[model samples]
Target chain A: MRLKMDFMGLSLKNPVMVAAGPWSRNPETIMRSLDAGASAVVTETIAMEVRQNVRPWIYSKNEGYQNVRLYSDHALEQWLIFIRQIKKEGGTVIASIMAHSPSEMAYIAKSVYKAGADAIELGLSIPHGEGVAVMGSDPDHMYNSVKRVIQSVDIPVMVKFSPHVTNISELAKVVEKAGASGISAIDTVRSIIGVDLETSKPLLATYGGYSGVPIKPIGLATVASIAQSVKIPVCGIGGISNWSDGLEYMMLGASTIQIGSAIMTLGSEVISDVIEGMDKWLEQKRLRAEGIVGKALSNLKSFDEIEILPYKAVLKDACPESSCETCVVGCLVGALEKKNGNIVYHQELCNGCGLCVSLCKDQNFELKWRL
Target chain B: MNIRDVAQRAGVSVATVSRVLNHPDQVTPKTRERILEIMKAMDYTPNWFARGLNLNRTGVIALLIPNIMNPIYTEIAKGVEEVAHNKGYYTLLCNSEDSKEKEAAYIEMLLHRKVDGLIFIAGHLDPDLMTRIEETRLPAVMIGKIEGNWQFSAVYTDYFEGARKATAHLIENGYSGIAHITGNLRFIESAEKLNGYREALKNADIQINPKWIIGGEETIEGGYLAAKRLVRNPNPPEAIFIANDWMAFGAIDAIKTEGFRIPEDIAVVGFDNNRMSGLVEPKLTTVNLPVYKMGLTASRLLFDEMDTLSSTSESDEKADQKQQIFLPLTIKVRNSCGHQDRIKAIFGE
Candidate 1:
């Protein structure tokens, strides 16, 4: 199974790194996560000054959790001290730097590297930074910011990019061109979780970064594009809750996986199970953690590049005398006809897209496989 | 020149001038134009303080519902509007369409419009909503919503008791095996109804067959398919207790299509005494829900809180605590659950 992995030039015991968030804010918290089986840990996005947070800074609903905590509240000196302590304890710590400008970011990067952090992760994806206005998505700002950190620090510099952009792949390429050692695909998208009809205001009222199980599809898509577009490794992070999610990220070419929200919800204990499950799965499939990286990338192709297959919907069960007529109506190709409930599959019309199969999977009009 | 001078110049009443200025829809186009022209000619300006004094009350309450198309929701809408009208308040009805995104957008727009209060017909209070309610300091009432043990200011019908009555009635009619059709058990109301069905069977000392309890979609088609499945089974139930009226209609149609005679072969009882209850061939026997009353009472609660909300000196954190309101339910027995004596009398004659 061999769970040992490497991110950039730094060798990691495993691929799982805790993303820079509230969980990784303090030295004590980061150390606790390391002890909980995280191969590497990222310090929460730290800036030059400590910012005071307001009451009720987080909102959650059926979709996801909206976080308004933009950056670390700890002073830069405090973070440098924490990094030194964590490094002395042999923790694979990655200091996260967020500053007002490239010069400030370069200064923080130099300080953290001097403090003996294994690496540094740039907070270039914050929707809104407390001290520094987030201009991370701007190509000029991202390039200048990453270039400063890269020139200042000898350690691997990973840039986490926000998904709130028109072309994330282009953004990833810009950071990579700036000499970023790796890319962390997806910072939370600015989202309004829900609204309080009672108050006539947005749930949080302010646009907040959203992350959870619901944001995985978009996050994975970002990871795939960045992995395919750039030469540097991609650290897939966003909506990763467990082992399966971690595996999915690696399969999509994430050399290292970062977890944030799942650890917050499931607690530090889930770290062990995730690593263990990944270990067991890799062994059961006779695969290595590094080998699985980009295994699914070959399958990630453009729409025009895909090869269409020919097949028709087949009926397995006895048809009803009178149907709800769901599959017949759902078929975009008009390949299905239901008289009463008697199904007549138009074999020639089927393209094997299997839209009807999904629609009728658990319904009265349970369509069979594409044959 | 002021608004008074404009009214004098236009040969119209001051009220007409005010109406054209504030409430233009109430003024005819001809009168509105004349007043505007007179004001322009006189260079008349309404006193800023006087305008504030005129439209003192915002008097707008946002009523957010899951779907306006749902008959039950429409009834609740009528109820909210009726009560709001009595209070000299206008209800801004917004259909969230059961989506959290749409709900959030409407809530923001309504809040920006300075709604005096809000009423949500939500089954679950999103934690985000809870925070927004706290931050805005607006009096809000929830209608027919409950999540876990946390009770909100909700007006929900006693679905369990109503369902128990329906099931008990079928038991009383000498129907041994009774099947209950319901929406997904994820919903609090649906689960409550199911529990009532189970309890009724338990009280009657009859074994509850798991297979007979069909979990169907909350639609007419779902009910039809589920009813067909139940009837085609080897040991079919003699009577059915459908959770809602719309689905009950479908079930009745399915039963008829299956060549079953009402009461003689099978008996059916539905919930929600909707308009279509009496329109069908054999009228539906159902649980009469206080739809209008639920909405009316919930709105009344919001109105009462609106008083305290307006006078913030009296309200504190405790004022935001949710209050749960449970309304009573009654059975509306019709021809669908055909009385044996009545059926016999009709056929015998």
Candidate 2:
């Protein structure tokens, strides 16, 4: 059976999605992503006024980074053309809006809704100056700001969250409370790659946001947490480079997965890989996209759900009767006692920590939760 | 020919001729027509060679620009034009396109044109080109940051300091492991920027991880690819700083695709303060390289040298020596670097 992914009340043919980025900036690119098998494509962030003279490169030395000015307000007519083209191409398009204020966001959101956009993605967070400062980062500000856009538009609204916050779930919940229809979890992480040691400056700008394979784990964890915390459908975003990565998000309760950097490197064709891989995995597992949503999340509880075994049991498990006993010898807990070529656990001294599990290669040892 | 001879041949007073040349509107149409007709009839060409010999001036200046496609260069060109026009010297705008060959070619063309001075933007001068420049002895000023010996005066941003400041900003905000995506390492600016990043890390006492550093073409597409490669690693750096704003956009886009949130999972910073940096959802915090000021300063220095050469009697042998100059840079803190609070409160941030 064909799988249907639902985000809030919106239904998607599949869980695979194209994240807002360069592809979203143009309708042709967005359609290409959809043609490649994406269920939906988020358009580029719409701003109040276009900027100019945005050079793409900056210098960095050793550990510093720099950023140069770039961006201009795109012509409204051009945006309309792009939006209209996406609709005509039989593609689902989500208009992503970025404005200076709540009022401005509301106006832009309303216009985008009227312009044939299937949905509106409010860019609640961005890595740059005005965006993060004005709309994102601050809970109260983001909540109120997103509320304004939600009130202005009748269509489903997805608030894209910034990952820079300490608690992504909290932010997601706040946006949901503010009446956002859905959440696009995790934007680019703020980071500095490294510096050119020879120059004593940054590699790009003196500083910049980082996104890539390295961020996938963080993206998955955030999506898992947000999915478990909020009732609103979550659109998982981040280092979705391939089908497996997209599946990981779906399993973690993501209704839709957005791919950005992968499309950048592998082109829109990556959407096929994500979709095909997801389909194959679903068929093999006898599950549908909807079934996969919140699957992994169901097994997850609060942070306390994780079980920690005692050190004594961990040490005994580390030194199994099998050939792998190196961990027992290295254990500082002194909780292991060897008997008949096997290590035995001392329950009284057991700490329930899983350090031994990390060290052991054998399946004989496992960490179980206890009250 | 001499001005007097040209006026006599044109059958016009010297004052009238001057007015016709400098301010044609001041002359009667018939008188101007007659003067132009007479001048053309006599093929009255001005003795520029003799005038140069007498005034010791070439009335030409060389302008070196990094890339024509870069708007910063265009802005610098405007500044240079403003100064050069006011100083009565023609500025020769040359695009290096960040290639050593193009830079050499433009330098050769400027030298062949016998420009009195030179303004070098962001490019390296090859040994042969440097020798040729030295042989020409033209007074020149270097604009933008460069490394090595300060053989000539230059006007540039302190890229090292800028990079350091940016890194420090990220570190101060609780970022421990940071990664950098850099530009072509051949340029001195790139090297200096790398040094600043290192300095910031050292100051923070953070052990540098070599795996995090990735270099690529200074394009948006390059940044996107680089970010993808870096993030795919088993242990990707928590934060990333890109070399340029355009590339940062690519990186940000890539990160978002990977489903990571900016500043939450990883933080990003960029350079150049390009206009687009501010327009994106998360405005980019970047360095303001004072390109216009550099252009203005370079032009002023070139004109000053030209004036000095014009006043001084130079033996033909002494005409082969060249000089250099340097400038300064500033940082424009914006949202991309996690300075949203300041920016939201005020536009200047």
Best by TM-score: 1
Q: Give the distance in Å from residue B12's predicted Cα in candidate 2 to where it truly belongs.
A: 64
TM-score on 0 to 1 scale for chain A of candidate 1: 0.88
lDDT of 1 by residue, A1-371 (tens): 28888788989889988988999988788888999999999899876445577557788776478987867887554566677677778899988887645755776787688778888888867764321223566888789889988877788999887777777778888988999999987888777788789988987746678898888888898899899889999999989888999999999989988888888788988788889889999999888999999899998878999756545566656555464577788888888787655788777787666677677754433333454
- Candidate 2 docks at the CAPRI level of incorrect
- Per-prediction TM-score, chain B alone: 0.77, 0.77
Q: What is the lDDT for A282 in model 1?
A: 92
lDDT of 2 by residue, B170-247 (tens): 887788889998887887777778888889999999998988888978888988999998888899888887887778
TM-score of candidate 2 versus the correct structure, residues matched by position? 0.47
lDDT of each: 0.78, 0.70
Tell me how far the alpha carbon of residue B172 in candidate 1 is from the true structure, in angstroms, after superposition: 78
